[model samples]
Target: MAILVAFGTIDGAGLARSEDTSVDALQLHGPLARLLRPLVRLFIRTGMTFPALSQLLRELYINVAEYDFALPDKAQTDSRVSLLTGIHRKEVSRLRGAGAPVNVVPAALSRTSRIIAYWLAAPDYTDTTGAPLPLPRAGEAPSFEALVSTLTKDVRARAVLDEWLDRKLVSLDEEGRIRLEEKAFVPQNGSEQQLYYFGRNLHDHIAAAVENVLGQAPAFFERAVHYDDLSGPLAAKLETRSRDLAMNVLQEANREAHSACETDAGGDWRWIFGIYVYREQMKPADKDIGKDAS
Candidate 1:
């Protein structure tokens, strides 16, 4: 008989079906939270860093299942994924062995196929072309424990590439699956274009917000405003300054710490002083109807 497991995800909860035995659920948590964690770690290994991963986890964690990547027609199967990702099937297994997040102990593997199955299948069944495949044609469905066993192998690969990624890029689903994601890779056409994307998105976003607040006047902002500074004489002066004076202070502050950056509504990014309004829109003038009448 097929076993079902539940896992918690940052985006939402999911369910996976596996060939392994079913287990009990957590109270402060649910069955889903217990299932889908391991995949989060994989994402970290792939190249995202911890802070980025945490940012993604905090804002949006997807409750993925086995079918999302394991289904035959709709999703990429394990063997196929092993090939595509350039990691061995055995290696994936070892990586997973490092630990899954669901169990209270965080030592061995957990049976999370039902929850994982849903995670794998959801995007394929709903968003993509993959279908609701009942089972594999070539082999028996992997036991939930076996699936965990298989995935643990990727740890070696993770070791090789850990420095390139941030810790946040790796995440744990409730079922113990690992997952990873970073900004989509953009093919670099020229010099550091791709490298700039990460910083740029944030810089532009903050710049636009400052502009809106300033209306027509050129706006300026500062970065790395230390808490201690906020309590000092500079803070009092900033609070009392006129708009232009404040903008200058912001610009000067940014110059002092130009390396610091910020993001705004549009997602564009710039350093505190790196952002500047080059042009200003003039205010509308009053109507002159007396000259128009014939």
Candidate 2:
């Protein structure tokens, strides 16, 4: 997620006031560029031209300004949206009718994720040490069929198992028990499921950061530890250690959340707790720049 530095307060209409608008825009430039660099690389790799992205961004700007920044009790007009977003009024009117993008999580993806969560968190599916237990293919409450049944009765357990096996998420052992892979929760690389999660996770993370920067009360928990100039071996070691610690935290949170939701009166609210670990080797130029700065 990009680190945002707020230069001004948002008005009731959710816009930076005119007086500080330029300053806020200038302050935002660097972080926005940094954040988009990786995304731009992805766009290029996926053969998305600049013009296509530009049009998408234009629509998104109009959409956000129209719906999110509308003045209270006042009908949002194309003129106002264009003014706020700096798009032409005609374009704003044209695209506003196009509607905001819908983010629909695939039914299979949603069900699969929840099933994995249960396997990792539900008392019936986990061992005494809180680790997920290998389960027999069918029959009985702690079996694979039972685990899937808790989430959905519409889909057959055999079908889910077949898909999981195809995706390398689970495997059958010599004892005929189904075992979740070490990274079972992670969707297969380059698959649509992975792309869905890629967007969702990043969106939630960046949204939290944006809210905090906007000076929301009781800031969302956002913190990180960073160190430069570590040896290759040390970085690897730290990555492994961080993975272990992060997984423990995630699993415990999942268990607590699952238990709470079991008795939760349904609500419109949603929550996500995510963790990421990254390690990149410093380039020679970057090292030189660091040394010069020091």
* Candidate with maximal lDDT: 2
User: Native-vs-model 1 lDDT?
Assistant: 0.34
Clashes of each: 103, 0
Worst 10 residues of 1 by lDDT: 285-294
Per-residue C-alpha lDDT of model 2 across residues 1-294, encoded as one tens digit per residue? 112223222211122333321246777775677678889999999999999989988988988888889899999999999889899998887889554455788998889888998999999899988999999988988999988887899999999999989888999899999999975766667887898889888888788767766665566766565566888998899899999999999999999999999999998888899988888998897567445534
TM-score per candidate, chains pooled:
0.15, 0.88
What lDDT score goes with residue 200 in model 2?
A: 88
Identify the runs in model 2 with alpha carbons over 4 angstroms from their true place.
Answer: 1-23, 99-102, 284-294
Candidate 2: residue 3 Cα off by (Å) = 17
Q: In model 1, what lDDT does residue 77 have? A: 48
Q: Can you write out model 1's per-residue Cα lDDT over 107-126, one digit (the tens) per residue?
A: 21112222233323333222
Each prediction's RMSD to truth: 28.5, 5.5
